[model samples]
Target: MRTPRTAAVLVPLMLLALGCAPQNSSTATDTSASSGANQTPADCAQGKTMKDGVLTVGTDSPAYDPWFSHNDPTNGKGFESAVAYAVAKQLGFDHSQVTWTKVPFNTSYAPGPKHFDFDINQISITPARAKVVDFSDGYYNAAQAVIAVQGSPAADASSLADLKQYKIGAQTGTTSLTAIRDEIQPTSDAVVFKNTNDAKTALANGQVDAIVTDLPTAFYLAAVEIQHGTIVGQFQPSAGQQEQFGMLFEKGNPLVACVNRGLAALKSSGQLAAIEKKWLSDTVDVPVLQ
Candidate 1:
C-alpha cells in the first residue's frame, strides 16, 4: 500500500492479485478509516445519509454488468449493487431502506457536493480524487485486459512492448485511457471514445486495432460484443501493484467511518468474497501480458 506523505490512510493488501485495476478513470490509493468498527455502524441515524431513514446510493444510469445487472441497481443483482446492499446491511439498513440515484461518471467526483450517501460506480480511490472526495475502504480490486478481433495485430501480441504500434481505444475520462497512456505509451495517440460501448464499436469496426478495459469488461466484450473476439492478454498495472475500487462519499462525510466499518465486517465475514465470486470471473487463467 502507498502512503500519502500528508495523509493518514489505512490500506490493505490482497494475495489474489492479477491484472491492472483500471478503474472508470483514476489511479487508486486508499484514503479511508484508520480504526475498526463494532461489528456494524454504531450510529444508524438518518442524519448520516443524504435522506433521513434511507441510504441514498448513486451510479450511472445503464449501470453495466457485472457491476450492475439489467441496468437496474435497485435489483441488487450485479457485483457493486450486491456490495452496496451488504454495506447497507452492516450499516443497519435493509434493502427497503436503501434508495438509488442516477449520476454521470465524471460528475460523481467533480469536487462539489454529492447527491447520494455514497456512490459505487467502479470509481478508484486515487490520491488525486481523495483530495476532493472521501472513499470507503476498497470494495473491489480490479485488473486490466485487452481485446481484439481475431487476426488483428494486437491479438498477435505477446507483451506490453508489442502493443506500441497499435491504436488503442478506451472511454473518455476513464482510467483505462490512463492505463493506455501510462502502461502502453503507444506510438500513436490512443483513441478516446464517449463510452465503453463506443470504444467496443470502434474496435469491432477496425477503427482501432485494440481496446483496453478492466479485465472483467474485457471478458464480457470478448464473450458477446466482438465478432471473433480474442483476449490479447492481461497485465497488472504499475508492475503488479494492486489498484482498487472504493465507495465514494462527499468529503468529510462522517458516514465514511461508518461505511468503513461495514466494509470491514464484510471482509471479516467472507460476505465480500461471496459477492465478488458471484459477479466477477477468475483471472488466474488469463496470461500476464508482460
Candidate 2:
C-alpha cells in the first residue's frame, strides 16, 4: 500500500513559496497611473513608497498551474507568489497591504502607463526589453532543458547534433522555444503550444518526441504529470542564450532601486538561496539568480 505522509508535513510545506510569478504584459503607462481604492500619487509615478501602505501587483488570468496553485497568487502560496510577498515584506508592506490584479504577459511590457506595482511571470531579462521596462535584481534564475518520453530518440541524444532529429514543442513566445529553434537546431519541426499543459499532453500522445522548457517546469511536468517521461539533459545557453527572471518596473522608476536593494539583501542574508533550494534546485539545474 502507498502510505501517505502525515498531513502536517504537507500542510506546513504548502505555505512555503512555490516559485510563481506574473504572466501578463504591461507598459509604463499601465503602472504609472493612480487608480483603485488605494491608488496614490506615488503610484502615478510608479513610486515604491506610496500612501495606504499597499503594494499592488499585476498577474495573468487563470495564471496557470504549478505557477499559481488555486488562483491565489496573492496568498504567497507558490514560488513566484512567495517571492512577490517576500519582496513586498522587504519593502515594508504587510500581507494586508498587498494586492493582486490580472493582465496579459505581453501586454504588461508594451509601451504605456501601468496599473500595478510590478509583474512577475517568469520573464527573461533581455537587453531589448530593458529599454522599456526596468527589472529588479533577478529573483529567480531559470535554465532551458530538454524533456522526452522514456523511449524517444531525444531521450538518447548526447550531443547537440543528436537533438536535431526530434520534433519538439514549447510554449509560444518563450525562451525555451527560441532555444530549440535557434540553438538546438532541431531537424524536425518545432511546435508551439498555448501553455505547458497542452505541450505535455502532446508529448504524451506521441505528437511530439520532446518538449523544451524552463528546467524547473520541465522537471515538474516529467515527475508529476507526464507518465513514462524523463528529462534527457540540461542545455547551456550559447553565448547569448542565458535567461534570467527579474522583478519588473517602469523604466527609471525609483521603485526599481528599492526592489534591487531588497533582493540584494535577501541574497546576502542567504534567504534567497534558501528559497531557491526549496522551489527550484530539487527539480532543475537552474542557478541561483545572479
Candidate 3:
C-alpha cells in the first residue's frame, strides 16, 4: 500500500532501530574480553635477565656495617642488601629468585664483561667511571666523616683547617681517599689502604692520626668495630653538591633501564627513605666539620 519512497524510509528506520537494540550476550562477552586484554600490565619478561628467571646482584665481600650487616648480602639486613631486594621485587623477582655474588669494589667498574646484572657497593657516579660502566640514579647522598681515636689530637679538631696538620688514611679507590687529598689537603700524603679494615687498623695503631670514611661507616666503626674510635666530624660535600652512591652496571647494559625503573618506584613509594632510616640513622648525631 505504500509508495516506493515510503518503503525506502521505512527500511532505514527499521535498520536504525535494530542497530540501537541491546547487544547479544555473545557480543557483550567479546567486547569485555578485548577490554580486559588491553588492561593487563606490560610484560617485564624474565628473558631479559642475566639468568632465566633469576636476578644476579653483586657486592664486595665482608660487606661492611649499615651497608651489609655481618658481611651478608642475602639476608636483607643492611641498607644495600635491603635496597637490592626491593629493586628485585620491582623487576618481578621474589627474594628467592635473587642470587648474590662477591664482586670486589675496585673490580666492579672495570671495562669488561660482567658476571652479575648490577653491582651496588657505594660506587660513586663519575664521568670517567661512566665511560667504562653505566650507573643508575643515585640511591644515597654521601658525606665524608673523620674517625679518630678517643683523646687523639684529630678528635679535638673542630674544622678542616684544624685537621690539616695530621695524617689521614682511607681505602684506596674510594671517595674517602679523594676527600682527604682534595678536601682536607693534609700536610702529608693521604695514606691509602687496600680495604677499610686496613684504614681502621692504621687509625687505631697511630700510623695515621685519623681516617676518613662515609658518615654511616664512621658511625658503625665508632659504635661497634673500633675500640675508642670517635667520629671527629662529617665534612661538607665539595662544591655544595652532595656526593651520591649509585648502582653499577655493565657498559651499555639494557638491564639498566629496568633497574632504574625499580629504583624510581621504590623512591616514589617511600621505601628508600624507610631503608635509610633503618640502617643509616646513626649518622644524625654526628657533627658537620667546616
Q: Which regions of candidate 1 deviate over 4 angstroms?
A: 1-39, 42-46, 281-284
Q: How many clashes does each candidate structure show, in the order listed?
A: 4, 35, 0
TM-score of each: 0.86, 0.75, 0.83
How well does model 1 score by local distance difference test?
Answer: 0.72
- Give me the runs in candidate 2 sitting further than 4 Å from their true place: 1-51, 61-71, 240-242, 283-290
Worst 10 residues of 2 by lDDT: 1-10
| Candidate 3 accuracy as TM-score | 0.83
Report how far off residue 239 is in candidate 2 (Å).
1.4
| Candidate 1 vs. true structure, TM-score | 0.86
lDDT on C-alpha atoms for all candidate structures:
0.72, 0.61, 0.70
lDDT of 2 by residue, 1-290 (tens): 00001100011111111012222222111222223324332332243544457788877765543455556787676567777777777777778988887866656666666787788877666655667777666565555667789987778877667778878888775677777787788777789887766788999999998888766566566766789877777665666333567666666666765565556567777777666555444322322211
Higher-ranked by lDDT: 2 or 3: 3
The collision pairs in model 3 are: none
Model 1: worst 10 consecutive residues (lDDT sum): 1-10
lDDT of 3 by residue, 1-290 (tens): 00011111101000000001111112110112222232211134345668988989998877877778778899998778998998888888899999999888878879999999888887766656776787776677667788899998899999999999998988887778888888889999999898888888888889999999876677777767778988888774557555667778888776665665666667777888777766665324566788
Which stretches in model 3 have alpha-carbon errors above 4 Å?
1-42
Q: TM-score ranking from best to worst?
A: 1, 3, 2
Q: State, as a TM-score between 0 and 1, how close model 2 is to the true structure.
A: 0.75
Scored against the true structure, residue 159 in model 2 reaches a CA lDDT of: 65
